[model samples]
Target: MNKLKRRSDMLSKRNVIIPLIALASLMCCFQLARDLVDVEKNLDYCVTQAGKTLAQINRDSVFPRDIEKDGKRWNFVRKEEWTSGFWPGILWYLYEYTGDAKWKIQADRFTGYLNPLTRRPAVDHDLGFQVFCSFGNGYRLSHDPGYKKAILRSADTLATLFNPKVGTILSWPFMIKKEKWPHNTIADNMMNLELLFWASKNGGSKSLYDIAVKHAETTMKNHFRADYSAYHVVLYDAASGKKIRGITYQGYSDESMWARGQAWTIYGYTVTYRETRDSRFLDFAQKLADVYIKRLPADLIPFWDFDDPEHGLKDASAAAITASALIELSTFVPDRTKAAQYFKLAGQMISELSSRHYQSRDSNSAFLLHTTGNKPANSGLDCSITYADYYYLESLIRLKRLAVNQTIYDYLR
Candidate 1:
């Protein structure tokens, strides 16, 4: 009789536990559905604001770069400027989101301004920034033959800066004389490698792929310290490829972690891993990302420098860039627990950035504010930068795609 009673009680408990589990799962699904709806709404808002910024900048017939805080005016740049591609890249993203013809028209026009860059000599490492962000996205969306040709040409030109002995591309030819860096490679150069990687597979030389891998390997070796916090600049011996010193040109100090520079490594190594599927890059990227996440403030946004004593200034651009990279990195990591953590962190960052605290809203036409371009030089501090807007939209798109079980690489061929 006691056994029968115990069996009955056990069955009852199982019944109750199963229902509770089902309810919890149902609630999780409901929350995810709501979050995805919010993502769509936020993307819609972005489309509206980006359209307004486009109209305002179109009047000046130039690409939007950053805002002048003193006058609260937009700063426009010509096509040759390093930042010129982000404006068109934003337009391309908007068109991809809305499938609207107007954005495509403007994106095409703005991207065409960069065609001249294909014929010019490789001025610096920024050719990837100037050509790939604009023409690369254009090719992805439209598959335009002209865009492909330009990307191939620009990739070849960018290769000219690579010295085989240094195992990395020279970041600033101009800075060599001005700063006495025999061969300098910055963390920012990691971003330019994507153009070379894409070009290598799409009608360009295979040497481009090798160059990119070599640069990434070299940067991974020399740019990061024991804690995986990256230095902004690492000077190398041009002839022997020896790392002379790692210093900071833009951070608060030589040893402090620059927010954007570290963000670039997170994003850059994520891309390198994706392109090569190398476990070394993947593991390194996770380490870099983990340190950045562990050190971020409660809101998931970072100060201009992680080691800054004051922590007075926040950088929305760095937050946006990190969020975008984290979302993509989450997809690549093999461990489910780590992946969930990364995705959750990225979602938190997106939530914070979407709030009025970061969004420009009525204050400016730019998507987000409080980006620090160069705090050391006292330039573009607390400003709305074009790259901030570009990457914020990108993160939104990536988040939305992930909600639908789509990968961030869905758009890429």
Candidate 2:
């Protein structure tokens, strides 16, 4: 009788504490949900504006008729470019949420435009970016056979990029300045590995998995820097398995730091960490994140080049990439405080981009502005780039998906 009375008293205390905790958690969730709504509104606005821009691009009469590149049905667009896929990823997202027929039609048209490229196979490192993220994601969403076939074909092409002699993957086999760039870039190849893993599982390509692992092991050894920031390019003797050289390239150009590269390392190694569960990859991700967080500005925006004269100052793409990385990283780390910080930064940057950089006034070009493409290359400086749009939407979609389900890491682990 005394034991029963004590149990009842404990239960009464538990009820009080549980309710209080629930109330606090509920309030916190409400604030997060409300903030997510505001940010999503901004996303919708940007999406609509981007659609208008592309629609204008579709209608040739609005642009300067004399200009060949900007014409309606212009060769520059309504087509695929790496993961941009002529906005197929964006259209797919619209179709997924709104069931809009027009978006479906556009996505189908994009698939048609991309289907031919799969036949010849892109001999470059970005075939996965060009086809897999677009077509593969489309296949997952719609279960369309054509998209699946296209993705497989792209994987086949990606396989060719893997030269066993080097035990590493090469991207941009196309010569820079007519000199074949021999260095195996860390980011580009890692980006392709997921597709390879998919290929190994989907089609039973055992060698492909082995090849990817070898490349990853080599990358972990060669690409990582002392600060865990990672080298942009590391040259290896294709025959000797020795790292021949390393360069900063678009980084500080003296091996300083590149913000997007940092983001890429965080995402890439986290991915590798998932594949291998090697503490090294996870550790690398954490270290790069540390360097990244230390440099982020109040707006959560990073500069074009980290370690540049103005690091963490002017780049939206870096923020977008980092956001994507952090979302992925949060799942791998046991403690998600850092992940939450990165996610918050991503949210803040999304707001910041909408308020300042997103093209509210322009109705003819899709996507928010202020994307720096190949900042080190001096290409598309401060112009809207397609990959930025793709990744930004991807991050949001990731959030929307994860809200209902456990993270990728949950299943992965």
Q: Candidate 1: lDDT of 86?
A: 93
- 195, model 2: CA deviation in Å? 1.3
Candidates' C-alpha lDDT: 0.84, 0.60
User: Which candidate ranks first by lDDT, i.e. highest?
Assistant: 1
| lDDT, candidate 1, 1-413, per-residue tens | 11111112322432222123322332334355346337877888888887777767645348888985533567888887899899899888888777778889999999998889899998899899888889998998899999999999999999999999999999999888897778999999999999999999889999999999999999999999999999999999999999999999999999999999999999999999978888899999999999999899998889999999999989999999998998778777766667667777887888888888888887878888888999999999989999988999998887665454344654343
In the range 1-413, model 2's lDDT, one tens digit per residue, is: 11111112332432222123322333334345337436456556655855764554544212211111122221253233454452666677666545567767766656566676688856577777667666766775577877777776777777776767777877666643355556455555676777776667666368777877877777777787777766778876656657777776666675767777777767777677766667777777778788888877666677777667755236566777677676666655554455555555555666666564554234234454565556567655665656666667766655554454323222210
Error of 2 at 226 (Å): 0.3
lDDT: worst 10-residue window of model 2: 60-69
Which lDDT value does model 1 have at 351? 87
Q: After superposing candidate 2, which stretches have Cα over 4 Å from the reference?
A: 1-39, 59-86, 275-279, 310-313, 357-364, 406-413
Which 10-residue window in model 1 sums to the lowest lDDT?
Answer: 1-10
